[model samples]
Target: MADYPRHPDREEARLDMSISQVWAAERISCPHRDILRAYLAGGLEAAAQDYVAFHLEVIRCPFCLANLEDLDAATSAEKEELRQRLGRAADRTVSSSAVFLERLRDSGAGG
Candidate 1:
């Protein structure tokens, strides 16, 4: 079972990596999420003076940035709904496949 969250609308919600989400953040230290919020809100310079390496790496990762944009686009309720549906689908697939394999073994048809 895959533990990472998956979103079907990810491609649709993707945003280009702006300079705010990329450079100009390496010299400011802060929590990644906070830095992102601050950057979005025109407060990038207020992050800190120690330089945020990990946060900049996150911003530079295209996949991570796309997921972050998807998150930003979703309302709390919509995000929760998606999470619940994916979890339930994964659980159902796992359980059904296990039962089918067990039945196959009992019937002497297991691969």
Candidate 2:
């Protein structure tokens, strides 16, 4: 075989590839969104919750952490929106009741 010059960064590239492969494997093992959501909601069983906690706290998987953060934010926003909607509905109900009561009084129905 003819001798060829080796690239100086070949080892570094190989190391980077190895690291990427490990990262890909870890990501593949990550729990799906539904499981993550259950974990967030405290709906998972003890064993499943423990596993998720280990993955998040010990492994510190960046992707899962980001997903969890996104889920939390979305949940908070939804709750706030629902609260505002309920508040508006309550205000409308109160206003309507007041108007009805005023009309009743004006018509001498309260006597």
Candidate 3:
């Protein structure tokens, strides 16, 4: 019989690899974008938040993280665009009101 040298951490490494594989497999079942968005907004219930936290922190699912990041960025961009649009509208309204008031005063209708 031949003597074989055994690595002491071989079993532990195999277990770790299997655990990682399991987590990777779970990625396919990641939560939807709505849930992820709610998680980002702190709008989810405690239990749902915990699950999302585990999926993100423990499982480290890249797809969900990327989706969350994209949603957040899009949200910020939408907000900025809305703000700019409102500002432009307000400017136009103010200009129109000023013109109307000036014409009224010039036509002796300001009394």
lDDT of 3 by residue, 15-87 (tens): 8678768767766658899999889889999999999998888777888888888999988898999999999
| Candidates' C-alpha lDDT | 0.57, 0.88, 0.87
lDDT of 2 by residue, 1-111 (tens): 999887669887887677656865768668999999999999999999998998788667789999999999988899999999999999999999999999999999986
Worst window of 10 by summed lDDT in candidate 2: 16-25
Using lDDT as the measure, name the better of candidate 1 and candidate 3: 3
Per-residue error (Å), model 2, residue 16: 20
Q: Which ten residues in a row are the worst by lDDT in model 1?
A: 47-56
**lDDT, residue 5, model 3:** 82
Candidate 3, residue 80: how far the Cα is off, in Å: 1.8
TM-score of each: 0.33, 0.66, 0.64
**Number of colliding residue pairs in model 3:** 0
For each of the candidates, give the backbone clash count: 0, 0, 0
**Ranked candidates (lDDT, high to low):** 2, 3, 1
Kindly report which residue stretches of model 1 are placed more than 4 angstroms away from their true locations once superposed: 1-74
